[model samples]
Target: MIDGWYWKFIGVGLIIYSMIVGMLVPLKPSIELVAPSAAKTGQQINLEVTGYNTNYSGSASIRAWLKDEEGNAVLSKNVTVINAQNLVANFDIPGFLPSSDRVVPFTLILDHPVDGAMVSPDAVFITQDSISKVEGQTLWQKDIINDLTLNTAFTFPSMSLIRETIRNTFYHVPLWFAMVIIFGAAVYWSIKYLRNPQSYQYDNRAVGFTSVGILFGILGTVTGALWARFVWGSYWSWDIKQIVTAVALLIYMAYFILRNAIEDDDRKGRVAAVYNIFAFVALIPLIFVVPRMMDSLHPGNGGNPGLGANDLDNSMRMIFYPAIIGWIIIGLWLANVRYRLLDIKYNLMNK
Candidate 1:
C-alpha cells in the first residue's frame, strides 16, 4: 500500500499544477465577423471583425477572403485593423458570382509581430442573390498552411456562449468526477460490511467514504449552479440533469439520517450498509439514465455531445485528466482521515 503522506504530497502537487496551467495559458488568436450574415450581389459591403489575441495594430499585416462551396475564392479583400481586437474588411461582391441562400464561408489571416501567423476559419459572408455560373481563377490555393506557434502555457479554445467562463471547465467538471470515484469506493466498503457484520472497521470506512463523497457532490452542485448562472441565465434552471442530481443527493443524504435514527451499534451498521448499497444502485440511474431521457442544458445528455469531438482538445486533456485524478486522491485522503478520527473517538468513549 502507498504511504498516506505520499498520497497527500501527490494530491497537493497535482492541484497546484492544474491551477497554474489552467489560468496562465493564452488562447490562440481568433476572429468573429460582426457584420450581417447575408449580403446582396454587386454591392460593396463593410464587414466588422472582432478578434481575440489577434494583435491588430496598424503595423500588423492582415488578409481576408470568401470561399464558396466549390472551394473557390470569389472575393479577396484587404483588412483594416481598427485596434488590437477589432478590424474591418471591405468586400465588393461581383455581379457575375453565383449566389444562393446557403452561407458562404470565409477566412481571416493575420501576421502579428509578437504572436506570429494565425488563421481564423469558418467566417461567414452569405448571399441571397440569383445563382449563375461564373468562371474565375481561385485566388487562394487550399494548399497554403498557416501554422501557429504553440504557447509555453497551453491555451483553451474560445467557444461561443461559454467565452472566458470556459476556464470553469477545469475546476467544475472535475468535482463530480472526484465525487463519483469516492462514492464508488464507499459502495465497495458497504458491500464488504454486508459480507462481514462482525468487523466494525468496514462499517466505519463505509460511513467515512460516504461523508466525503457527499461533501464533494455538494461542492460540485454549487459550482455547477454558479456556472449555469452565467451560461444559462439562472442559478437553478430546472434542467433535467440538475433536478435529477438534486434528487440523487437527497437520496444519499437519507442514508446518513437513517444511520443516526438507529440506536443499537450493530443494528445501525447492518441497516446503514444495506441502505448504502441501495442508494448507490439508485444513484447510477438517477445521474445517468434519468438525465439522458429528457432534454437538458448539461452536456452528454439529450442527444447533446459531451467532451468528444472538438469540445475537448489535447491541450485541455493534459490538465483536465490530471485534475480529476488529483481530486480523487485528495478525496480518498479525506475519507481515511475521517475514518481514523471516528475510530479514535469510539475507542476513547468505550474506556
Candidate 2:
C-alpha cells in the first residue's frame, strides 16, 4: 500500500508548483481598450490605445493599422508612444469604407518586433461621409500593412474584455472541479452508510467530506464573486447560474444542520444519507442543466465557446490541467484529514 503521507506530500507539492507557475507566467501583448470608438470618413482619427503586457516606448519600429472585415486596411500616419502600456495612433480615415453599411467596425492592429502583433477586434468604427465624394484610393495614401513580426515568446493569451482576469481560470474553475469531486466522494460514503445503516464510520466519512466540500464551494463563490466584479462589472449580477449555485450550497449546508439537530446516531446517519442522495440529484440540474436552459453571464453560456475552447489555448491548458489535478488532490487530502479527525472523535465518544 502507498504511504499516506506520500500522497499528501504529492498533493501539497503539486498545488504549490501549479500555483507558482500560474501566477508567474506572463500574458502575451494585447490591446485592453481603445477610446473614441467612432470616426467619420474623410477625417483624421486620433485613437487613445491602452495595452496589456505591452512595451510601447521600448521599440522604435512600432506600427499600427485599422483593418476592416473585408481584409482591407488603413495605415496610421503617426504612432505616439506615451509609455510602456499606452500609445496614440493617428489614422486618416478614407473617404468611404468598402462596405454596404453606413458604419463599419475596424480592428486595431499593433506590431512591434519585441511585443509581436496584438489585435483588438472592433476597436473603432468608421462611418461613411455621404456629403463628401467617395474617393478611397487617394485618401488611403497607398500605405500597406505588411512585414509584421510574430510574437514567438512563451506567454498566456491576453484577450480583450477578459484580459488579465483570465488568470482566475486556474483557481476559480478548478475550485469547482475539486468541489464536485469532493462532493461526489461524500455521496459515495453516503451511499455506503445507507447500504450498511449500522456503520457510524461511513456516516463520519460522509459528513467529513461534505464539510470540506461546502468550504470549497464557499471559496469558489468568493473567487467567482471577485471575478464577476472584474469581468461582469458586479459582484453579484443575480445570474441564473450564480443563483442556482448558491441554492445548491445552502442545501448542502442544511445537511450539517440536520445532523446537528438529530439526537440519535442511527437516526442521523439514515436521514443524512437519504437527504444527501437527493441533494446530489438536485445539484446536477442546478449547476449544469438549469443554467444552460436559461440566460447566464458565464462563458460557454448563450452560444459562446466553453472553457476548453478559444479561451483556453495550449499554454493555458498546460497549467489548467495540472491545476485541476493538484486542486483535486488537495481537496481529497483535506477530506481525508477531516474524516480522520471525526474517526478520533467517534472513538473517544464510544469509549
Candidate 3:
C-alpha cells in the first residue's frame, strides 16, 4: 500500500512540473511577415504563418486573423501545410474606409491547432501623412524620424531561454544603473581605503563587485549583439548602438588594465576607484547621450520614434516583463554567489 502511495505522489509531482515547464517554454513560429509594422494605408500586406511539430511527426495548420481596433474581424482564414514544418499565408489589407486618412491600425493573429494555442494578434499602424497619433492624441510638431513607430511581434517555445534573454533588461540597461551602484560603492570604499590602507576588506569588496559588474556588462553586450544580428543583419555592425556598447565595454576593460599596471594594491584600489567614477560618466555619453544625439538603427533614438503600438503588443509583454525580472534576479543571484566565493577565497589565502 505504501509503495503504491509513493508512486502516486511522484505522479502528481510530475504533472505539476509539466504544467510549469509548459508555460515557460515557447515554440518558435516561422517568419510570417517580413515587415508587418510598416504598412501604409491601402497597402497590401502578406503574412506567412509556419511552425514545426515538436512532439509528433505529423503536419500542422495555422489560422490567421486580421482584426480592427474595436475587435471587429477584418479578415480570417486558415492555411494547411502538408509534411512541411513551416508555412506562409499571404494576405492584403483591404484599405481603410477613406484613403484620405493618414494612419490605420490592425492586428494579426495566428492559431496553432497542434499546440492548442492562439498567438494573440500582432498590432501595426500604417501611415503616409506627416503626423501620427500616440494614445489617441495627435502630435503634429514631432519630427518624422522621431515620430515613426514600427511594431512587430513573435512567440517562442523556450521559456527559460526566453527568460535568460530577458536579463538583457537589467543586465543590459540596468547594469549601467547598477554600474552606477557598484562604482558609487567603489568610491565609498576608495575614500575609506585612502583614509586607512590597513583595512583592506573594503578595497576587496569593491574589487569583487566591480569584477562581477564587468561580467554582467559583457553578458549584456553579447546578448544585445545576438539580438541585433537577428534583427539588424550583422552581429557586429558599426551602428550607433554597437559603437556605444563597444566604447562602454572598452572603458571597463581599460579599468582592469590600469589596475594591473600598478605595483601597490593600495595605490591600485585608490586610483581605480577614481577612474571607476569616470566609467559612468563615459558610459552616459556612449550608451544614452550620443545614441540620442546621432541617428541610430536602434529603437528609442532622438530622431527615431519610441516604443509604441506596433513595437510591443500585449502578448509579448506578458512574457517580456516577467523575463526581465527573472533575469535580473538570476544575474544578481549569480553575482552574489561569485562575491561570496571570492570573499572566502580571499580569507583562506590571507589565513
Question: What TM-scores do the predictions have?
Answer: 0.87, 0.90, 0.53
* Global lDDT of each candidate: 0.74, 0.84, 0.52
Q: Across residues 108-219, which tens digit of lDDT does each residue of candidate 1 receive?
A: 4545545555555656555535555532232234434344344343567866667677777788888888888888899898899899988777888999999998998899
Ranking by TM-score: 2, 1, 3
Residue 95 shift from truth in candidate 3, angstroms:
14
Candidate 1 error regions (>4 Å): 36-38, 68-72, 96-99, 102-125, 133-153, 300-306
What lDDT score goes with residue 25 in model 2? 89
Q: lDDT by residue for model 2 over 1-351, one digit each (tens)?
A: 124588777777777877888889899988888999999987888999988888988998789999877667888889999999999999888777766577889889899889998888999988885633245534443347788898887789887678777888888988898888889989999999999987788888898889888998999999999999989899999988689889999999999999899999889899999999998899977886787787668888463323536768888888888888888888887877788788889889989
**Residue 74 lDDT (model 2):** 80
Off by over 4 Å in 3: 1-188, 191-197, 301-351
Q: Give one digit per residue, the lDDT tens place, for model 3 in 1-351.
A: 022244444434443443354355444443333235656644566554434322212435445555555453444333545334444445554434222457656565554544433333455665654432342222111221122112232343322223334323323444444554555555566567667777666666556656766776777667778866766678888887678778887887888899899988668878877787677568766765677677777755354422334444455455444444443443444445555676687678779
Q: What's the TM for model 3? A: 0.53
CA shift at 11, candidate 2, in angstroms? Answer: 1.4
